[model samples]
Target: MNAFQTAAERLIQADASHTPCEPLRDLIGEADQIAAYRVQEMVTQARLDAGRRIVGRKIGLTSRAVQAQLGVGSPDHGALLDDMAYADREPIPLSRFLQPRVEAEVAFVLDRDLDVEMANVADVIRATAFVLPAIEVVDSRITDWDIRVTDTIADNASGGAFVLGTTPRALSEVDLPAIGMAIETADQVVSTGAGVACLGSPVAAVVWLARALATQETPLRAGDVILSGALGPVVPVTTPGSFCARLSGLGQVSAVFTQGEDA
Candidate 1:
């Protein structure tokens, strides 16, 4: 196998076995962002060949805080597979991840194809069928979360799984930039943020994602779920517990994590 393909296979194995691997940069000698995304595509294609369906996409690092933490100035993305989706309040198996964390988000369900360059917030709102509350379960396979932009991009933006809320609201029903989120564990409210924390607004994040995909000849399709990064700080899934997120005007979504059990 070529270097990229070999790296892709290693990542697939790492994900399947729930084991962490050395960063791709260490293996491939300082791969740039372009090279990392190429590895991501290769790995995603392998999953497709294995019968995993691409249900949607996820944007990461849209929050300035997260970007600063990761030392990146721009957002990254990953493909979302059908198997990675969960219903609200569903139990998530802890054994399926190497290391996991959860973050609250606003999810956009698209109603039409968005393939144009320079998409705006209005365009995104127009294209979206509805917005729902979501929780993204992010995991890292690059040993100890020691990752650069390239490292994460190649690891499918550190995506693990996601759960969607039952209630979906039209954009007109709520102010996108002013929506609030409270992410709580069983004990206390762990983190809180507003929709503006996500690149000013979640719709703006979607516009960025749509334009990014359009440049690569891929359009945001109808029925696709787009996660608009984190609305608050990400919390580590260190113990088994129920986690819930309440979004202003949108409703709530949650997930349970259990040790040594299948979800």
Candidate 2:
């Protein structure tokens, strides 16, 4: 197998076993961004071949804190499969992931297909059916989270699972950039942020994701839920507990992680 395919297989195995593996960079040197994306495609395609359906896409590293930590100026994208979605307040099994963390985000449900080469914020806003509060459960296959941009990109942008709030608001009804977010665990507020943390505005991140996906000949389709990255710092899922994120006008979403067996 080629190096990229070999790396992709290793990632697939690691994810299936819920076991952290050494960084792919250690096995085959460092992959360039393009090569990393190719590896991601290979891994995603394998899942598709195994009957998984693509439900949407996720944008990562839109927050300045994550960007600075990863040393990347731009955001990365990942495919969201149907199985990766959890119902609001659903209990997630902690044992099902290698190393999981949760973050608050605004999710956009698309009403129309977007495939333009240079989609703008207005275009994204127009195509958005509604905005909902979401919590992304991110995990890394790379051991100890010691990953470079390429390592994460190849590992599906560290995408794990996501939960959406029950309430949905029309895009025109809310101020995209000024919306505030508060995340709590066990009744204590753990993190706070605003929509501007996501590439100035969550809408802008959706726009960028649309344009970026267009370059790959993939269009954002109707009914697709786009996760516009994190609005605040990520909280480590070291223990089983319930975590909730409340958005200013978008309502709230909660995820419960349980110890022992998979839920």
Candidate 3:
């Protein structure tokens, strides 16, 4: 098998065995981003063949500081499947993830398809039906989260699951770049940020994603939920508990992590 195929199989096996594998950067090289994406495509196809339904897409590394840290000028994205969705306050079993972390962000549910060439921020806004406060539960199949840009891109951008707020607001009702966000675990606020932390604004991130995906011929479609990058820092969830995030003007959402199914 080719290196890309080998990398994809290793990641797939990691997910199945619940054991984090070594980084793919070693096999694909640190700068070969195109090869990294090829690995992601292979893994995505494997999941689709296994009957997982695609629900949407997720933008990652939206924070400029994170971009610099990862040495990438643009954000990366991954597919969102039906199995990776959890309702607000729903009990999410901890066993499904190897090393889980959570981030607060805004979610846009598209009203129309975003298949146009060179989509702009205006196009994204026009296509968005509503926005919700969201929490992206991120996990890395790479051991100890030892990922560079290429490594993460190949692991489906480290997407695990997402919980969205019940209430939705129109684009006109809120300021996309000014909304405040805070994530807490019943005791205290762990992380806080504003919409501006996400590539200037979440809407702008969606525009980037639209253009990026359109180039790959997998354009965003109506009813697809887009998880814009994190508004603040990514917090690690090491224990069984609940994390709730509140977005000013967008209500709140919760992710309850339980030890197991019977917990």
Top candidate when judged by lDDT against the true structure: 3
lDDT of 1 by residue, 1-263 (tens): 88788778889888878789888886555537788899999989988998999999999989787788777788999999998999998888888888899999999999988889888878888899999999999999889998888889999999999999999999899897898999988769999999999999888889899999999888889889999999989999988888999999999999788786554
TM-score ranking from best candidate downward = 3, 2, 1
TM-score for each model: 0.96, 0.96, 0.98
Ranking of all predicted structures according to lDDT, beginning with the best and ending with the worst = 3, 2, 1
lDDT of 2 by residue, 57-142 (tens): 99998977777887778999999998899989888888888899999999999999999989988889889999999999999998
TM-score of 3: 0.98
TM-score of 2: 0.96
Candidate 1: Cα lDDT at 91: 80
At residue 225, what lDDT does model 2 achieve? Answer: 94
Query: lDDT of each prediction vs. the true structure?
Result: 0.89, 0.91, 0.94
Each prediction's total of clashing residue pairs, residues at least 3 apart in sequence or on different chains, is 0, 0, 0
Per-model root-mean-square deviation over C-alphas: 1.4, 1.3, 1.2
Q: Candidate 1 or 2, higher TM-score?
A: 2
Q: Residue by residue across 1-263, what tens digits does model 3's lDDT show? A: 98999999999999999999999987999878889889998999999999998999999989889889999899999999999998999999999999999999999999899998799988998999999999999999999999999999999999999999999999999998999999999689999999999988999999999999999999999999999999999999999999999999999999999999522
